[model samples]
Target: MDPRLLELLVCPVTRHPLSYDKAAQELVSPKARLAYPIRDGLPIMLESEARPLDAED
Candidate 1:
């Protein structure tokens, strides 16, 4: 994802800044522990589409 776009993207639920998880290919909301998928090079920012983070992670 582009840095410019990442700067503008926020958590769809928490409205907090999201961190780019390159290895996971997802945009992670640290505060929310939600990982939104990046599909076909586009981010799917919807809450329903995001996956919950595992406790151990």
Candidate 2:
């Protein structure tokens, strides 16, 4: 992901900043407890499409 794009991206639900988890290749929103997937270098930030946080994460 581009650094400029990362800076401009936010959680679709809460409009809060996201943390890029490079290891998981995801953008995590702690406030919303959701994980938006990064597929093929594109961020899927839709709340409806986001995955809920699992304890193991």
Model-by-model lDDT, in order?
Answer: 0.94, 0.90
Give the per-residue Cα lDDT of candidate 2 at 45.
Answer: 82
Q: What is the lDDT of residue 47 in candidate 1?
A: 95
Q: What is the lDDT of candidate 2?
A: 0.90
Off by over 4 Å in 1: none
Worst 10 residues of 1 by lDDT: 48-57
Model 2 Cα lDDT, one tens digit per residue, 2-55: 889989998988999999999989999988999999999999988887899987
What are the C-alpha RMSDs, in order, of all predicted structures? 0.7, 1.2
Instruction: Give the per-residue lDDT of model 1 (tens digit) for 1-57.
Output: 999999999998999999999998999998999999999999999999999999975
State the local distance difference test value for candidate 1: 0.94
Candidate 1 TM-score versus the reference: 0.93
Score every model by TM-score. Answer: 0.93, 0.87
For candidate 2, the per-residue lDDT at 11 reads 90
Where model 2 places Cα greater than 4 Å from the true spot, the runs are none
